[model samples]
Target: MPEIMSDTPTDFKHFIRIIGRGQRAGRTLTMQEAEQAMSMVINGQATAEQKGAFLMLLRVREETAEELAGFSQAFRTCSLASVADLSVDLDMGCYAGKRRHLPWFLLAVMLLAKNGKRIFLHGTHEPDSKRLYLKEVLPQIGFKVAQHPEQVQVALDTFGFAYMDLKQINPQLDDIIQLREQFGLRSCANTLARMLNPSHAAHCLQGIFHRKIDEKHRETAALLNDANVLCFRGEGGEVEFNPLRDVTLHVSRNGQQSSEDVTATCETFITKPQELDAKQLISVWTGEFDDIYANHAVVGTLSLMLVLVDKLDWTEAYQQAEQMWQGRDKKWPVVLPEDKSEVVPFDTTGKHYAH
Candidate 1:
């Protein structure tokens, strides 16, 4: 029963038969039928078997928070980047891809670019059979990878940190990375590829693994009024570091949202990474095990980037995360990677799935 276009359906097989008949009758679609079934899969007009039956019916009865804020407002109106200047942009990483570890948000964007803070970062690379990306661990940690989009705005205006990549800033959303490996799972293009912010950062710091996509990332940062967002539930979802607790952060300020339990203050600051499961964190991130789980995932990603730039509030962000784990060996080449086998160690036994 497809044909329902004009009277407000807008194709994509009439919004995938009204979200595959509300997931074949189990129901839950109205946020105007999940924003016309994500504006018919972001305007391509569905059809890869109706986008693999609306991504296996929104991955089996999940999605809400107004149907993930109507699929992040039909994916920020088919974004391609233009959400700049959210007060000196602060976008963070891990929109999935880096199964085990070593991607301490590329050393917390190189300590937020040696503390002047501009940072952008995007993904894609190490695709066909993944592992090792931040575009190959941020050029082994010195940070190049721009290659266009005006060298990612001249490396975010002179090395405050840039990166970009997603097949050079968006090759038709990186040609749907082979329909995300032909739906072997993950779609809505991996939550609209972490809401492709393009430095439209009104202070964002994403990292998802699921908690029902943190209400579609707080309704896509309150329909892009995005003044300060922070969605969490990280680790194997990539954005690692929570040695036995304090990871699940989720916030969304200025847009006003909330969440809690950061693993009892991130397990009271580090210490348990020498082969802690998941195929020994992918054999210590591929060097075949033991750089002390990439130095406790760069001191738990610089104490979760000083608790996302509040510069030490959550109990002084755990006493400056215990002086960043005793000056982590003079911040070891600023969080390793300059090709030390792309700092691996992460397979904490996968499968957390939700969004």
Candidate 2:
């Protein structure tokens, strides 16, 4: 048996050696071992070589549910301030999708807020390799990212929306991003990062790309006991209506789980952009695509929100979302080439503007 260190290892060299040995032998890390390894990485004590090894091991094979649970608990312990008084019924972890469709997450959050629902939206915009992120776009829609947990609550109370940047809220976790890039592929960290719910919100809306991760996400949330999570194989990994098909919504709420097939089979709801020689499909997503797509996303969101608030029903929620969509006079802001004309290179030190 490799002797377990009594004091937490302060450097990445030990982390790499431990994780690599476990991976090579086809062994899994104990929950304790996993937490310690991650803590070393997050706390910036790991050496560069160890950081790469740890991330690669996790990338080659996913984390076990036990390990994931341990990591989540450790993360909460190391980061996140206690805000026991604030009750966040919903926390939406919005990943920037492959197809940069107009960010429906923001729209959904706004609608939920208008209806008097408390919500928290948490994410980061690093590895800006492709697609626009909420961290970059929320300001365009008139929201600012919260600087602290208290600010998050205040924003939720006042604006119905609160943006929590992973870096600002948990600098320790943020430190691992650069090291994560060294591995050149998304490992468990990418998945785990989305699962970070700082608000300790009992309800979550998580969007993922891989189908396998969906069940794991459910198990992870169930482990937390208090969380009622909805995991969607999002349209390109973000919450947007798929132009090619109806969206698949997999919901796990109140310990009961179900899935709804939301395919866009109607002609009114479907459009052939290629035939129209539409240079891009951008116009439709920004323009009115269909009442159903809008309603589906809203109801899907509300279903998660409803899990938090006992008074809301699916039918009533859908109707409410439809009313909101109909009331909008103009199309939501969809990013275009012109939108990027003024974008300064992401300044690490400069303040982030939402647009």
C-alpha lDDT score of every prediction, in listed order: 0.57, 0.59
Number of clashing residue pairs, candidate 1: 13
lDDT of each residue in 96-129, candidate 2, tens digit only: 4333334544566666676677887777765634
lDDT of 2 at 279: 18
Error of 2 at 285 (Å): 13
Off by over 4 Å in 2: 1-4, 8-24, 43-45, 82-85, 240-248, 251-320, 327-355
Error of 1 at 262 (Å): 20
Query: Number of clashing residue pairs in every model?
Result: 13, 7
TM-score of 2: 0.74
The global Cα lDDT (0 to 1) of model 2 is 0.59
Minimal lDDT window, size 10, model 2: 272-281
Question: Which candidate number would show the highest lDDT if scored against the true structure?
Answer: 2
Native RMSD of candidate 1 (Å): 18.1
